[model samples]
Target: MNLIKQYVKEYKNTYIQSVLLAVLGVVSGLAAYIVLAKMIVGLIGKNTEFGFYLQYGLMVLAAMVLKEIFAAASTSISHQATFYSLKKIRQEISKKLFRMPLGNVMNISSGKLKNIIVDQVDSMETILAHIIPEMTANIIGPILLLIYMFILDWRLAIVSLIPLVIGMFCMKSVMASYGKKYQQSVEINQKMNNAVVEYIGGIEVIKMFNQSETSYQKYSEAVHENAAFYYHWMKETMIGVSAYRKISPMSLLTILPLGVYFYLNGSLTIVTFITIIVLSFGTVENILTATNYMDDLSRIGTITKEIGLILDAPDLEHGKENVSLSGSDIELKNVDFSYSEDKKVLEGVSLTIGENQVTAFVGPSGGGKSTITKLIAGFWNADAGEVIIGGKNIKEIPLEQLSETISYVSQDNYLFDMSVRENIRIGKPSASDKEVEEMAKLSGCDEFIRGLSAGYDTIVGEGGGHLSGGEKQRISIARAMLKNAPIVILDEATSYMDT
Candidate 1:
């Protein structure tokens, strides 16, 4: 709720204006009810003057029109503010992810992050754009109507509220364990999402290893678990929910019976009785409309809290200074690092590579060869020692400057879904088309790229899925070659390339 408040504050002017318009709309609706009641009273009293009836009829029509116009305007303004706020929230999350530690980013599965960014963020739109202004209008309108009813006849007004109290009790019972149930639903949904993503992403692997049936079983089990959780939760709450729905709309039962009793006792006038009945219906209707959004409102707090966690995640410490590098000489001084508390990847490691020298670290798998390169590339800070580049501790260099000083091509380089030219240009965004082609030629990919249907402009599918393994590797190499950084670290970069 606080996170929602903060975002609403960002667009306070629009939010305020929308709420004011909604209030105006509700007022218009109440005015229409009043006009209708006046017309009905006149008709019942045998005052069938054509002009009087026509005048009241015109007023009711005008009030109804104004109500619709104001309601539409409020909805339009609220949607604009809601979408813009969501956009800002998404952008903040994206920037936060960029600054966070790579390890932290990797720890969260892609499907879960997608759920937060796409599904969860999108869910807030309905609550923010529609529920906020509309629900406020619904609640306030009923209160105003109830106050007018009390002024008409306080005794009957209290009678009219009996159903509302009962409805509220039912609602409270329904929501007693709503938070826990909703939390369970969210957890189960995320598990299903993760399993679905993993299943689809590993479909090829499953087929190759003849484990498709087992993988499918896992995915189907997750799906069933999610469905069963929701079914049971809804089953548990159905009784209370049904009671609320039945009770909230039954205002007329109390109003009609009590109003007749008062009229029979000579304590209530026909006009006042009619007015109370008309207005009571509107009050109950407004309350019912408001209660319709309770589920959305309840979930708002949970969704925003999840998004806030991402936005408030801690970022790795970085320096702002961009120092000049004398040369590409790299050094590690008694460095120690561990990916986790229980496992040490590198310990008391000290080494130096001279400028213009070719050095290879030959070791068994898991011997920290990749870790050493990542440290030099500033992917992660060493836990116990400093990694020096050109006489300056790597941590002291600004990220942008450090990136410009190194070109790291890993064994599994990812390619964007774009034309070859555009993908290559990512290495040097300002490079001309000619410069990109030259780099592609240098990386031995230009000949194959030229033979494609659109040549350099050919659309490479996601992760270069349309290209062969060797071709994708060459394109990645071309991109890295375009960077032209002072130091190039190739971690099995040519593994996919042909002999």
Candidate 2:
């Protein structure tokens, strides 16, 4: 339901068209089948409808032809709708990640977030395009067919329905119990993602501290847990599928015997009985199709909840009027902050930073220096008091405008997996190649970058793996410098460099 609501919001303009096309396609396909049944039964019967058979045959053929075309059109429209919806949904999620407070986004790691951004969003397209529409078509096609069968013969209608009922019960049991195991699977996957990211990011540290064994153990355990959860889920699913296969067949076999009994007792006609038997195959399929939709509902619901939690996270501060702080000094007055409500990191601590001056935050670890820096940079809001710039409260200033005033260089500089030139271009997007090279030189990155074989055209590895820590830092500083901001707040930017 969450996925559906979000999907509707994302593609509201196309919602009606997609739904209408699906309904039209399903109805036309079923109508084509009905027309054929009527035309065939009409001929060589007590009605003796052979005279108009050719005309009706042509009509049926046209309807059949229309069904194919309409189904294709509907499927195509549905694909487009799903594509657009997923695209917008991913963008919305990215926007939320940008605004969400620290705790919200940090609850999941970069690797998991990467998977969610890339793979999970794509998973929704499968749910929407194939699973959702096919499930709907499967259901609508079966119900209409059953209605037609009932109109022909009620007794066989009842006979054809038994296995469907039982299969549905199987579906309910299978899906309801699935939530626990699937949730476990997700947890294990998240843990594995975190472990892999941590291990890879600190490979040097692991070697330095002789912690490879410990990290490997953690990695193996997380991966093993994920594998075990998937194995369990598959084992359970196999059981259900085997049972469904075993029981769903009973429809045809049971329908024949019971239908014969009804016929022997003069309760049913031969033509009606044959038609019901022919359509009994459709019953088991309808149940299966409904179950498939249930499957999509389950997966989509999980991801939707995850995304919703992120979007609904509490903001650091309620955003207000847009104002730009141009080349202004920063002041923190009577500010207090706490990660936990009860314990304060900064209690009534105040500081001032002059514009264009290199101010260093020097204190022992956990002395709130980093916290103060983050607060001044507006990554977090103070619990009390104000961070003012250019005589305006930081919260009152539009983030982009405040951002325009200050250049930040944080530890663990993240570089996009693009060319060295392209990564630097993020700060001053309009910079010419010559300007980029000049900026790189100013930051001392030009020498190393030019030494690389690919130089500016090189595709950096993920998270800038191609560069060493010093190289990445210089590049980051150069990028920030290219912005030409009046103020720069660098938190632990030189930490990677030995003091």
Candidate 3:
């Protein structure tokens, strides 16, 4: 709950307004119960006045109307605040991702990241929009009613509290293992999501190699595990949950019998007895409604922890001051790097490529060829030693400035679901259409692109799925060429294209 508040402090005034409205709503509802009690007491006393009936009847109607209006207004205001807070949280996550090292970002599963950002963050809407004001009203309304009952007759008030205490005990028993169970569910959900994403993303390969059976088996297994976990968890907790639901709202169990005995003994009046019964039920109703949100409240910690994993991650070390470069030459001195601790991709490696000279590292597969290029591209920071470009350590250069000075095209380049022209324009967002076509011509993609149905206006589809591998490679080349950076590193950038 504190985690949610930290992100929503900017909207405190709006939330307060909502809470005030919610309180008014609860008071209106309680006012209706009071009016009912008055009418019932009047009838019991044989007051046959039509005006008395009409006046109390009208008051009850007015109370109901106000309750609905205040509730609707409060809900609308709360939803607005919740949406704005969610937007702010997502924006912060985006900024954090941009600041983090590409390697760190990649280390996290894409499926898990998506789940946290899209699903887990979205789940907070219930707590923010409904629980905040509603819970406040639920607690306040019941507490106020209980106080009134005490003033009327303290014995009945204590009797009304019996069910609440027992209900809480049952609820506590259910919640004992809730956190662990919910965490397990989250892990299983992530695994299922990952399997589904992988299956969809690799459908082409699966079909071509006739591996559908095995791939489907994995996907189905993950889904089954997710379902089975929830089923067993619910089965285990059903007894306690059922007990709470049945016992919590049954305040009448004690109130009715006790009120009868007190009234029969002449210690309590009929009017007080009936009024306490009515108000006790109302109090129990409010308390039960409030407790209904316990499940959502309990999961706040898990959800926040998932989101914090990304927001709290350590970012790559880089200087903000832009340094002047001596030249365009690149050098790696005593550099050591590894994707994992067990296997060193590059160890104490030194190399230099002079400015205005074409250079390439010839090596077998898995020999850190792409890794070296990526280090120069600032995709990952070296575990040890320094990578220098233009006689300055890369870390000394601002990430944005370093990016602007280098154009890197990897073998597996991704294109957004946008037009081919717009895809190339990503290299230089402000590039003119003519300049884009010029780069396409220079990269030998112009002829083929023009042959397509919509020419350069054609949508590339996700990751250029609409085009062949070779075509996508040429378009990527055009995109990088459009940047016209001083340093260009092509790590098998043309692997798909013919020589």
Best of the candidates, lDDT: 3
Question: What tens-digit string does per-residue lDDT give for candidate 1 at 267-334?
Answer: 99999999998898888888888889888877876797778768777776667878877899999999
Off by over 4 Å in 2: 9-13, 24-68, 265-267, 318-320, 324-327, 497-499
RMSD (Å) per prediction: 1.9, 3.4, 1.9
In the range 187-287, model 3's lDDT, one tens digit per residue, is 99999999999999999999999999999999999999998998999899998999888888888999999998999999999999889888887788878
How much does candidate 3 score in TM-score?
0.95
Model 1 segments more than 4 A misplaced: 321-327
Per-residue CA lDDT of candidate 2, range 245-319, in tens? Answer: 567657777779888888899987766666666566655555565565676667766766656656566765634
Backbone clashes in model 1, listed as residue pairs: none
Clashes of 3: 0
Local distance difference test scores for all models: 0.88, 0.75, 0.90
Clashing pairs in 2: none
Answer with 2 or 3, whichever has the higher lDDT: 3
User: For every model in order, what is the number of clashing pairs?
Assistant: 0, 0, 0
